[model samples]
Target chain A: MTQVAQAMRDKTAVCGVGLTLGNFQDKSALALSVEAYDLALEDAGLERKDVDGLIQLSFGNDYDRFLEAVGTDVRYAYQGWSHGRFIAPMLQQAAMVVASGMAKAVAIVHGRRRRAFGQLADTEMWRQGLGPHGESPAYGAMGPVFGAAIAAQRYFHMYGGSGDDLAPIAMAFRKHAQLNPLACRTSPMTREDYLNSRWIVEPLRLFDCCQNNDGGACLIITSAERARDCKKPPVYISGMQGVHAGPQFHNLTLPGLGVAQQEVFNYRPQKEDLYAYQMAGVTQKDIDFLITYDAFSPLVLFGLERFGFCGPGEAKDFIKDGRIELGGELPINTSGGLLSEGHVVGWNLFIEAIRQLRHECGPRQVKDAEVCQYGSFLGETVIFRR
Target chain B: MEPSYKVVEEKTGRYLPVIYPEELPFWEGARKHEIILQRCNSCAKSWYPIGPACPHCFSMSFKWDRMSGRGTLHNYVVFHKPWTKWFESKVPYAVVQIQLEEGPRLTTNFLDCAVKDIKIGMPVEAVFEDITSDITLVQFRPGKK
Candidate 1:
């Protein structure tokens, strides 16, 4: 059997990545977005005028506002949102736009003031608008942690996993955070702290949740040819894909009463990651480091297993012994991840991947790094070369 | 005849399920202590949280039918922390997902058991909790063998 490759693979490259000021609150989400955009332009050695396209999630400042602030003549713009908490979908969209010749360079940006305005679910403005409207919310499944807890519980039941199994992941990220100056949680966390922390939902402790902080991130994507002329080394978008659990029902799906399946729950993302690998023309062994959408700590465990980094239920063992840490077999989340670096959705994971491939991460850099795999709700695989 | 529902403050302070026109029959059935769902006429597939189209076959033609309300508890979570003002008193309560006999999983609370003792794959049955004059929430408990 032959495998057809991803059409847009290596057609576009990420030339610039920028982030706004960290946890310190001062700027509005819009202001932070503009700041990140300016920084990204500077990093790419391109001016506002060089940006012919803009791609952003709705949470960011308006494209017209961004163009007015930067004074760039934008030829194309798109507002995208992906299922679940994935931010890489917009990056994939930007790459396609650039590859199609509709735009020379596209900037994808995301900004959120979740801190200043209070938590998204707690704020009256969002509460009234968003409401606990979903089916699960009707049954007291209001916060993301609740549903995530259920998923974690199911994983534990199926794979002989326990809260103790996730201890190493939390500790590893905390250690990684210690090395990251931009991290929100810099203080070291002991195993006792992880276990003793109050449970938000059983099997999920305080440290399992990602922090809510004020921040924004932007990435600049352009044709592979144009990226070569940029100031920073380009991290090409080799292969990227997003996969949802096939249907709305069952354990693998979100906590909603949409459908039911009789089969044993077998939810894994390895097949999707394998498809991405084939598209990138690389094997799993070629990946030097990886980053996961660590909106919640347990997700890192799921990402590891689902991405085929290890066999089912082996992720708990695979991630131990400094394996996922720097200088280990496959260093992961070199930027400290959302667990420590503050949640900018999954955008930080992509930026961290670029930084690693560019050899910009001085202390947390994975040695001799080339291929970097990123797993979100969907999986994206990119291989970088100097 | 039994009252359609009983008015009470939602324990979790979350919005009660807003019954749209398409879901009126399901709620109407809940009031009668029966589990009703949408069955696609074309594929004979049943679904919960009633909607207009069949998710399996995309068939618009369907009928609301009563389910036996028997299922196995597929998974569950016990909330040790309350997210809203309403659920503070209900802290440490459990929400269970029951894979029903008719091939649909419904999200509801566990009844007649301590949250700590509920186990996965346990056979369960649906029960109703009347929330408002027109809203009755379906919940689950250990099935009587």
Candidate 2:
């Protein structure tokens, strides 16, 4: 590991986390964010005055407006657009702010409704370059699901799998959701039920997609020393890597899938792709459980391949026979993931990792969980330790 | 004959591409029934999703050159659910990504092709659709063997 990476390891920890899931049509995004912030402060056993740093994404409120609503101020503040890929970077930035002494504690916050006012729906698809996720609305190629659909089609074409292959991922996460009270779709989903679900896009059923609901989530990051005095055990921010981007790193797809301008090939993670494990002084074997950004089920397969848990095209076989289920070789998305749990813009994925590491997840917890990794298909990752 | 999906009479118009100044040549080429993109003078390569600089060689020096408009269908997906009211009648259509012979991929709709007929590696060619007086979308259809 590099000296910079060594110095950053385990210096900061997620001291507190708060989440609110399910439909809240009456509540505005700002109101939901304020509620989550209050709950986080209470969970951390810290007052609003104790927080001196703030980070947020668009879609809820601007940074200045959020501070005003919370009746507090911070020395360090930042805001980014609301995308699942940015969640890991936001958490990494919070850890850096605390580790670098910019703030004693930093709160990464988010609040979103399913169909909020000013939500970038149709307009985002027509963005100047390519719609974020390669959308071309004139062709009726809209929604983030289009990105997943195209990628899944390419994956199936290149690797030789069908829509039936995705049923296991949906079924596995649904099984995990059965144990999570906050999860949106917990009614038992059988194989027939999965095959019977209507298609949102070919090769992707309605079950492959995540649910849209109003929700809010927050995580408080502070130095490990201060975290020791908090209400819960600190989940140390052991290592991290930023989101990989460019022509090759298409949104919602693994590298070498030839989506957009990407070239077609079998993608394998080289040494640099596995840097987060090195920075944490651990390997895939050390990761007790994993949480990945699963806006769609195809992403779960891509995430596994991106992290080198399996080889290219091997994820189809690797995910079968309950391999990714709760007591399997690698239990992924134990809190049901965004696929089953609810999409809180991926903030809840991190919160799930924190909860699992703390052993506070009563029934859904991984057995003897010590280390967990939040990695995505884009290669953005954050490894946490109890 | 009526379609299966509900059609609203007072429907909001279709979403059109925002024509930026740099992309005027591409839209103009489409209006003239030609497919064009930026070809780098230094690298002698073409790129799509129109950009100022050449992605291959990072060269700002480029020209709007006409393409063969012949490519292989590299990827595609069938959207059964319509995102907007304008696409309600066009449900279960195929949106294909065609890899031009020049090595750049373009995302567009396939014309005069059934969703079941769309397959990877199939030869396809560009066709222009005059959706508006000022805007014409460059689409695709099956090509002769």
Candidate 3:
């Protein structure tokens, strides 16, 4: 696709955003979902009666309470998971519902506690038993971070980079958290802290992962035309795409040194074309800010490079420059990403993106910010727009 | 430090059993220091790591085909840390996922080489390393070897 083809043209705008109190553990996912809905309704200067549509993470919260909190009968509703792919697409669906006059307005929300349900919803083994094949026969059980760690281990041996190469990713996001008040700020994590942190799944350390907080977040979605009467300056849904080839065994491979069925990043930007390095027409430099879905630190490395922020394997260097910090080259997770900000599944991720574009941040706000980007768990939907 | 990798049975070979009939050939082959996979008889489907039925067809019938163990590197990642306490000494080792010439992907440890020498889509072959009396793992080495 040409650079012009990737340009942002206003489509739909986010009108209101709200986040529930992030808890270490307390209250169910459903309660948090309701709190966020009510707060978002209040934030937009609208009433519960205004939300006629709803979109939520299929794996996370309770839906009946979500419907009750919105005080709407629910004209349009959706729930699914291919990880983060569902986030932006669900918002797009809510936009279509409003645009088609099926509903006047929609509130999308979700929440979860990592300790309660393993946070990432990695239930591969739970489903393994029903299958007649009897997969558990082998010692190789499919856990969430199992494959990712195994792949990372191989990458380190191939690249000769230390585990410390991943530490900067964790420290960078945590450092971004200090300025974010709503973000979980206990201690400033250092690369040494990340290295010294307790191990969870093999190569991944506790500090290298994100907080699985007990919380919910909400975002009000409406068309660009209707948003003028609702709330917040609308950032259009410029270019959005979701792709799922298959499971990891069939799809993924390692970094520059590995092999796989397909070239991993089909949409990855290239340097020679300058513009080719972006997933679409715009470069990372164009966006005022972005949120890297940091469930695990290495993922941020992949996200940084994948989003065309920096060249392949250059995230370590990009991070060292403190560019993702406030007032740096580009600000990230001004709401303190999943790492420090707390992981409310991908629900909080949605609200953070809207909050940044609305310029509502006090200390973490990017100066003269216009365009913004947001992603879900697996980055099925990485929104790019103004 | 010496490079190594091992699996803790957790409970036992009973609770966390490693009994796979489709792997009769791979295991039997391993006893002889050979690596193989089950190819579906009815559908001509090649399955790695072994399975009871062909995902394509419900056929329980398959033949154990020995691999020449030669193929270009499909994709890989070098892990700077081990997945378990057993691999503590093996902090830096490559767990490669290679697409073999016989048309099936295999995940094995890469060794006998430096990290920088590995390249994308590079050729590699299997070299058996026995851990126990009857168990042998198929480790990948540079194909030219």
Candidate 4:
């Protein structure tokens, strides 16, 4: 595993970062993808001819439309995230295509008009005849918040968790959002505000949920040799891996089976995150900073544990006052993750990891940061280094 | 007198389950006040959300057996917000997970109880709720102590 990981290490690099449609309105999903793709090419200092591969990172995104809009033919074409979960899996695939000499430059882009279309509830996807269990119609199981709320309740019941323990995780990202101009919610939030926020679902306030925003984020990955000649300093991909800890993610069928299903989600935090880190050969201490996918607040708590930063139930204790804040022992979601920052799915975290690796985040940057890890329970991690 | 077990189709509302061909038998049994689960003939393992074959034995053949209708509350959540207009009246209702004695878990709602009274590890018994003439959604209520 280490040898395989070593083979990919520093072999490919992300040369360009393009974010075009965040917090905007009246923009179509395809338009956002094209805009982000255009900016990525500009940032990489490459044109249509430079991209031999293209990968769509979201559902319903027209690869044909993008191909026509760009007017460029590629030797290789692939679609990532047919389920449209996030970009980690897609990015990992793009890197592999680049590493295997199948493509010189792979352009990966994701676009969403979720807020513009008033589709804030992500669970609605299950209702659109995709999954076997149609949530709202069959059972009143509505959105991601409902599932997250149940998970939080179980965490509280099993681990003795409290809202107070998870408050810092929410506020820390809000603090980081204050420094991020592109973040949707930049206003500073106090602990009182978090507690006072209206409950969307029990144990989860409105603040606990991710903010809906129309956006697109893209990245250009190429061979290390090609990236060295690009405009910006190359940020190396040390390791990347994707692991699914459980069966499917529906509530009606699987329900709380995730807690009981050891094969899908590892009971031990060390084992869960290590499944990815073992390939990269990076430890928790080696990760200077982390960007846990914060679609929900408990996600940070869960991510902290899964990444081996703390014990199974120790995340509630691990995320103490100012511990994950800037200049602390370890900073997380410095770009105001899904909760406070706009939800580009996980793309913002991917872009932020690259920015932090490049030392470009003005105030929110992790000082002297060398290695950064981005991951979530759906189980994918990519360690980026300067 | 006991309530009728017939599932009237016209009475079903917007939240009724859309029964596919494979799920027909489960609903048919629910309409008769019986809880049925698919048990593999080879491995003798039972599973929920019925699949085409046994995950344990990978056998295409299985049996639909009646359950004792008793289980333990694994976990639950009380929805403060409604998902759709149909659920608007059901706000603040607790959605519960029951770990059946047959080794399968079911997502259901509790009847005849307050949301606050629900507890993990508490005993629960399956109860059938006929929403339509052809559809009966299986639910759970507090089991006899």
In terms of lDDT, which candidate is strongest? Answer: 2
lDDT tens digits by residue: candidate 3, B7-122: 23443321122334435567667658677777789998775546677656779987777778788666444445444454556555555667888777766667787866766578
Residues A1-386 of candidate 4: C-alpha lDDT, one tens digit per residue: 65776788878999998884355567788788888888888888888799999888544456777888879899888765433244677888888999999999998877888644433344343332223222433556556676667677777777796655678888999999899888888887998988888877777888888877788878999988999999888888888877453354342221222533212233454364455566667777898988887878887776676566776677787788688888888899998888877877677788889988889999888999999988665556888888
lDDT of 1 by residue, A1-386 (tens): 11434677788999998985376466778788888888898999998888889987766456677777767778898876422343656777788789889999999877778634533344221221122222255577656676567667766777786877777778888888788777888788888988988888787888888878888788999999999999998888887665444443222222222223324545454454467777787877888988877777777876776667776667768888889888788888887888887787767778888988998888887887888888643344444443
Q: What is the per-residue lDDT of model 3 for residues A74-153, given as tens digits with 9 covering 90 to 100?
A: 77777666254356567667765776678877778876655566443433333322111112212232233444454454
Model 2 docking grade: medium
At residue A45, candidate 2 shows an lDDT of 95
In angstroms, give how far residue B51 of model 4 lies from its true place.
0.4
Candidate 2 Cα RMSD (Å): 3.8
Question: Which residue pairs in candidate 2 collide?
Answer: none
Query: What is model 2's DockQ versus the real complex?
Result: 0.57
Error of model 1, residue A99, in angstroms:
1.4
lDDT: worst 10-residue window of model 3 chain B: B1-10
Tens digits of per-residue lDDT for model 2, A256-300 = 999999988999999898899888999998999889999999999
Best of the two (1, 4) by lDDT: 4
lDDT of each: 0.73, 0.90, 0.60, 0.74
Clash counts for all predictions: 1, 0, 23, 8
For candidate 3, what is the DockQ? Answer: 0.15
Best by TM-score: 2
lDDT per residue (tens digit) for residues B1-145 in model 1 = 2322222245534556544556677778888889989898999989754667897889999988889989988878788887667778888888777888898877788989987779887889888998766678889989966
Residue B73, model 3: Cα distance from true site in angstroms: 9.8
Runs in model 2 with CA error above 4 Å? Answer: B1-12
